[model samples]
Target chain A: MALEANYGMVGDFYTQNFTTTHTGDGDTLILNLGPQHPSTHGVLRVVVELDGEYVKKAEPVLGYIHRMHEKMGEVKTYLQYLPNMGRVDYLHALGWNWAYVGAVEKLMGIEVPERAEFIRVITCELNRISSHLLWWGAYLLDLGAFTPILYAFADRERIMDILQMVTGSRLTYCYYRFGGVSADIGEKFISDLRAFLAQFKARIPMFHELVTGNMILRGRCVDIGVLPVEMCRRYGATGPVLRGSGVAYDVRRFEPYSVYDQLDFDVPVGKAGDAMDRYDVRVAEMVQSVRIIEQALDKLPEGPFLNPDLPDRFIPEPGEVYYSVEGARGKIGVYIVSDGSPKPYRLKLRSPSFSNLSLFAELSQGTLLGDAISIMGSLDLVIPEIDR
Target chain B: MATLGQTIKSLWSMVVGMKVTGIEFFKPKLTVHYPRKEVDNLGTYRGHCDLVAREDDPLTPKCIMCGICVDNCPSGCLSLTMHVVGEGKPRPAGGAGELMLAQEVILPGSIKKAPPTGKAERVLDSFRLNYNYCSLCGLCVQNCPVSSLAWSREAYLVGRSRQEFEFDLLARLRAKAASSQGVKAA
Candidate 1:
């Protein structure tokens, strides 16, 4: 029943498609777009049936960069596999780490102090900004603009510097421990972060002035890839894509964790469920993240970063829990089943991009080829995150 | 027809874009000619590690040969050895100092950590950096508890000999301090 709900079969649309009762005969031409082609973003192969450039059907082919990360999680001890969490979606490494560490903490029942929770929220929100910045840059680059990428990187570099002082690594940070973060942030860390926040807040408006208002970008995005609010509900879509379609569902707001309940920030939504709306939603989210970072900083506390009761080997009781975070692309969920051992019994990942990509077919058909790529660009589908 | 209006609008947008880019062209070029530029300084953004020594305490006990840095090393590129007068490998009393095996290996996250055989000393042995495979990710340098191992700002690390790249980084650092002192005195 899950499989049936998860996927449905479709052929060339001649008004007879999805009508199981109809009987008709028509020629169907299969069009394959990249397992190796440049446009599908990163190593994604899509099979599309074209009625002369008007796509009648679309099917995405995946499992190219599948590294069996969940299986590896079950083998490695909690501390040992912390680094591997970053490799899932390298762009939003901090959010992924937050989810993994949050799950482990839940299983162990460790209460993080006020200071650590505040710090985690600040860092996670900063990471969310960085992720959104990269996505916006990449999305524009995909749409044939170059300058916004550099602008995005300029802002992203500040976040990297702020993170590196405490986390020690930039791109892939193995900073967060099982119970809490490894090191206590120093004076320099907080000061530098404040400066970064001030500078970043001033620069965010430029992004709006640049692409969001650009006539070309608007014409390309506005009505393209219209995924209605109801379809989003059926597919269990989360994050900006779901929110963009006017569904008031956000993992951070719904399942508040790591001092998120303490801080106040608005979840931006859009009325029109189109490509432009998704773009607007993500940009607005960047502003909201800045707001969150400000609140977290203002209420910063002083205390221990790590839990006092943290064990060398984190062994959880025989139970299961699913922890999720609103990653850059969508909701990244980690399902862990522990048999009261050092390693997890069975681990499953509910990757957002994978489910997000599944909807590509619904949006792609009855659209031009250019519109399809535009939809893909707007979706911000990181192939590694999907393939993971 | 849709064709004439669309073409005119496209032409107008192109003109506006070109005008913007044209104004940018007059402004001092932010376009960095990365390959052509001679100034190798990466400007305050951490480029490489410099080994410094204290002036007052000539031989400022910089490293006590504690295995903290060794254990913390993500890649096996860092190595340190403390001399014990006359041990397995003799110390040269005069001239260019004696060559002895070290305690720790400080590698730049270039290679995976070889599981330590329980029999081997907890201290560093010899830091063998396989430069052939080094991605220069700088994880080892960051994780190095002592803050010794570093990403050489010398962007071009394509060395001729593997041995030339593979140095006793800690000893070389200490020796570098000593030689700089000698130059200052002279």
Candidate 2:
């Protein structure tokens, strides 16, 4: 150990955490890749064992940003816990919102209005686009490219602006209520979205020319940190991670939540389960999200957004239900157990980031030090969601 | 497993990447220098909870001191202290229908009465909101029976300490009421 980290910071939490695993004796060096490491994207401290420039083994240490969101659901009433969904995975908050609302709706057997379903689909897909846009930009930022994030934000800002029109908050949007959305999307919202899509569709090719097709990016990404389909299944990886591994198992298609089945959009799957494959899958998926939004916008039904004849209280009968929606990262599931109380007896959130990050140990083995960062970025780990 | 042709194609893609950035360099910058020019069109900005004045009375907010918002608040950021009028026990703010006087905090601006305004009329005591813990979830606004709670578009809500944020809503309401009345008189 090269002991010159004497800036009054003590305690070897890395060694303490890596007790079962190898903490490096001599030739192998132990490096903690941050609870706040810039490239880790969040408070994700990856204890990676290194042999010169190559990674020998990697272990992801979590729970630095735990907020006990599931426990909060147990104490708070059904309606009171609505805002917490926004904070869960803020990049794709609508997915969590739909998950929680859908779970509750299933328990109570509440029929969401047709217009509300369409609105939910349209808004959620747009949110998926925004989420992926952020990841794409942030992923490039992690890989040392600065310009792509700025360009990505230019488009992401537009999506957020359109979302902020109806959702009120730009980032943590608590728009969806129990039965329906908080507000209806006006004509201006639809027009703004249409214009954005038209411009964005043109810009995707530009993105390819700038970053995707670049030699430097391809050199770092292609055939690097390859995750096999079996490894993905064992790790419980869903969403783009699983899709990138040649599995077309999208929750929106396989489990048909919302109006996704009614709408037509191809799930992008990659041939090789590598970093480049994951990157390409996310990029292509954004286009699919755009298609979903366009279709939902055209088929926006005419009816009450919120259901009429509401119950006096949100007390669901003694029951349990599991509901899942396809998030930008993976499958966002909420399993609720109700003892006929106003609050949930037990609430559990199944975030995709958690499952996706679990395979880092297996994937990062024998890869270059820099390639680990690429693989982590491709995983699209939202640290808070994992900690939750 | 990149072939010679694929390698050459990827190398050429670097030139294409440069061209894309070169084209973008001439375009207008997307970001703005904040503090120099503020953002406009803040109509949808949900800042904090503002007590909506009653339809009849400008000074008095429609909050019945019922403390529904307090009970319903997920985070215990809200606390209300109201003085019982005559010979009643020190019950909670919203327990009775009597006109309640807000204790400790001075009723300046529009609500000038430290004592009871009248026997029939009800006035609120201090409705303390610790903005430090407030998530701005709008649960309080939705649960308010009188529809007296609403989100204020106050963009520049800055404070020095944690205590600075634990402000009384009644005082703010009275001040706003007085300022509006002053504008009308002027």
Query: Where does candidate 2 stray beyond 4 Å?
Result: A1-25, B1-11, B83-121
Q: Clash pairs of candidate 2?
A: B65-B94, B99-B122, B102-B125
Please provide, for model 2 over B92-131, each residue's C-alpha lDDT reduced to its tens digit, 9 standing for 90 to 100: 5422222122221111221111223344444477777778
Residue-wise lDDT of candidate 1 within B43-132, one digit each (tens)?
Answer: 222323333334455444233333333333323333344443322443211112122223122223312333233432333333334443
TM-scores, all candidates, are 0.74, 0.90
Candidate 1 lDDT tens digits, A42-82? 78888777666677777788887787888867665555467
The regions of model 1 sitting more than 4 angstroms off are A1-30, B1-124, B127-186
Docking class of 1: incorrect
Interface RMSD of 1: 8.2
Model 1: lDDT equals 0.69
